[model samples]
Target: MEHVVLTVQSQNQLQQALQQLDSSWLNLPSGRVLAQVYSRNLESGWLLSVSAELRAKLPNITVVGCSAMGIVSAGSDWNNATVVSLLRFDKSSFVATLLQSSPDDEYLDGRNMAAELAIKQRDLQGVLLLSNPTKLATTRLLRGMSDELVNLPIFGGLAGDFSQKLSTSVMLDQALSDAGSVIVAFYGEALRIKTFNYLGWTPFGEGMTVTSTQGDVVKTIDNIAAYDLYNYFIGIEKTGFFSSAMEFPLMANHGGKLVARVPIAVGEAHELVFLAQLEPGDTVQFGYGDVNSILSDLSFARHDLISFGPEAILVFSCCCRQSFLQDDPRAEIQPFEDVAAVAGFFTYGEIDTANVPRDVLNATIVSVGFSEEPAPAAEEDDWLITERAEMKMSRNLNRLQRLMCFISRMTEKLNAKNQELTRLAQLDSLTGVLNRRAFEEQLAQEFQHCRMISAPLSLLKIDLDGFKQLNEDFGHAIGDQLLCNLVDIVNRCVRHTDGFARYESDCFMLLLPQLHYGEALVIAERIRAGVAQSLTIKGIPELPKVTCSIGVAKFHDEQDTLDALLSRVDFAISRAKSAGRNCVKGE
Candidate 1:
């Protein structure tokens, strides 16, 4: 009997709760068929305390899992509790593959991965897989898995923080190593897999066909490198060479799979980065995720509840997606509740049958809702009410909601405008850093105050590593996101009281107070770390990662005026850059 597939989760008291489950569930008939118990992580490794007991009993039955947002136990405010789900399968009815390993393998390798399922020789009912989807081209992984396995009906999702998918998957008990995965594949009879294809994103602009290209990394489209084509559409200069285009594309479920055609990104330089995911020869359409549209899609589904609902569902949503209109998921829960009684955490990526029947893609959310009993017929009460009386009663509430949303939008716009104005006044607009005037004012203010107080103050100067080469390689947009991300990182590491002003194009200065000379070295190291990290901006690829070097100097009342401090830091900074792209040194 396929009973309820309940995934109980909590982020509190993880150890105690697991003990209670071990004693109670280990012997229960519900778990005897195969109870795979797993604990959650606190963004780190799960404790051996939680694992030692479970591993003792089910030595052969492997459970590949990880934490749910935080360390947890059941009923621990959801965010503080641990999560454990029981899959009671009729061992006779289904051939399940529990692939577990260390950093190297979860339970099985690719060869065993294909063989384990093939042995089931069970009619390929469906593939319910879950793994870490970070950085890995899951689409490519499964394409290979299915090509060998042949026509496996795929369902399920990337099992990680769907809400925050930036981190890679953390399979339970697996070594916390990068580029590792824990794969779970299930095959059996008595299971009917029905797939519902939905990209949910709608296309916006005109369609552009690929005039030329290669594999996933497109070389050219319409006789131009994909990047050049995008530059033309968005008005980016081609002074530097580029690989791809600013791909603004909508997602579609054509031929029973999800594909992002013509992916696009808005770079920090106000230019576009092409995030092309489709083949170069394929035609592309521009699209984006509209929060309102997604909400509307949910409402529309309610009307056609006859389509894919009425049964309980497990929703696997893309982790990259931060719900827009219903950003406050709690407020919007009622809407989804009305649909499938959905109780699915966000997914790292979703696996859906792709272009071919049963081929899976890398980044997607898969929803699997099972009905314990036959669904009841729709009734009059179930029909949504457009009640005039209730409508009148809720008028004030509706008005207030609209007003609040309007105010929020206005606040965002105002902030954007203020940032622009500040940048224009204080920065070299072309370089997008503090201008010469702001720099002078800041330095003067810091110098005078620190001089009077006899406090320790430090100065820093920075220059991009190989900036000219940046201009020679990919164009200016790449240079722009790099700078923006760099500044953002520096801001994150610096104190609010500290000041950062760009003195020239590709040159920035940081002023730190209330610190001694050696302390300045520590701050300099942090600045170096912040600027040297790479972040992928949406809609662009082939953006060379960013690197920078910092030179630090301390203010001495005797030898240091504002100009002297700047010159020393500037010189030290120049030396740092010359040594290597990412370093911090002090004088």
Candidate 2:
């Protein structure tokens, strides 16, 4: 099979492109011509004339066309221009159909189209879908198509308009549409198709939970107003949030893979609006994309196609990436020109039914490479050399890249070492609670804050009862296991905001920041009862139930020192030990 691409600058040049096709591929046995026309504000009637002209010129070949933001042919930008790619398949059987979707029946339309196509062509290997995304739900359309043919790999993008007026149009054969889709299925024994989807956004900061959502709008994230978080991260009001949020998209783990949810608008309640519906309580990480990482990802995609030896490379890159790259989208597309003919358009959202569980992706690049045979290593090596040579860089950019690499590695190693050191310094080695030093440091901070705000702060001192006798009877190993079990029970009883520490052997301290003496006494009693009820020593029937003596102390005014508070709590624990060891006392 052979393919030829013609780039036309204007309506006057349109005839020239068709003439090039006639001179080169006029008499091919079976072929298909796909045209991506640049739509100007000139007129809609011109489309009919252009379709008629293509039909007259290539009557035997199937002609499918669409309006695009910018036309790309062989990985070169040809905006305000038309790009036509003619593929002549020798052994493949091709079938093209146009299905119009009603406003309410887009899903049903997709199912019907797939079912009809399945009946017509039973040997299909894959499908190419081009849809008008202005009014139709493209995700539902893809779902319908998948329902009928689950194994078929579908690849294509939503049609686009030059002026962003939502005037995207699609054409199948001689028919045109502004609110429907066209499905083209290819079936044969000789065709081999491979697809790759790339998203290079790196997640930063902690993940936020989707606490509340309504349809495509997220009302609350982490219990804060979604728009408030949006404003905080984007550093802009609702008016500019949409444009500014393009750089940082929300990444959610869906279908076991990270998929981006690009924020498109602000809802009525100032909620962050997404292209896809998000369920409540889904964890999403917000992050930014790197330019170097984007290029690196595209380079890897190129390598995959090179290895596959594809004859044609079709790309459906998100419009966000195009705007991000601006004048340099060629950096993403041009790499594949050496290995295959490239044809693609920037899309609103990408549809990838090829994945094990189908997903509609946003802020991502989806690629499909078609080949009959694998490419050679020598040609791939030559392409690599050419690629490096063409990547002419300024001195500052080179230095900046090197510096970024060095800083990235250094930062990574520093973070890892810092985390290990912090873990060792802050946590008890025997039982994973806070060590005494860390607890005291934290206590000092909490104490000062409570004194300044006059908020309640309480402390608990706990000692396991009958420790020396039990150790002598059950041995030190059993005593150690029993201590560990007591720690677990205490941890389960305390609030997450409260801090617990191994004050010393057989003694533990608990700090409650927003609780008074009465609340602290209640928690101490609960811990006392929980340990007595749940703590068990295996294989030692001689031992009685494990219990603890507890003490509770509330922080007084600024005159009350941290040492004075500790002394009061320690004395209370002594009283508890004297008054029948397994009880709680407060002072």
Score each candidate by Cα lDDT.
0.51, 0.74
Query: How does each model score on TM-score?
Result: 0.47, 0.68
- Across residues 317-423, which tens digit of lDDT does each residue of candidate 2 receive? 77777665555655567667787787776766677778623556778888887765544456536445234213334465456456556655665687688789878
TM-score of 2: 0.68
Give lDDT tens digits, candidate 1, residues 35-57. Answer: 22333344354433344444554
Superposed by TM-score, candidate 2 places the C-alpha of residue 319 at a distance from the truth, in angstroms, of 1.2
Stretches off by above 4 angstroms in model 2 are 22-24, 27-49, 75-77, 223-225, 237-243, 372-431, 434-463, 466-587
* Number of clashes recorded per candidate: 53, 0
- Tell me each candidate's RMSD, in Å, in order: 24.8, 12.3
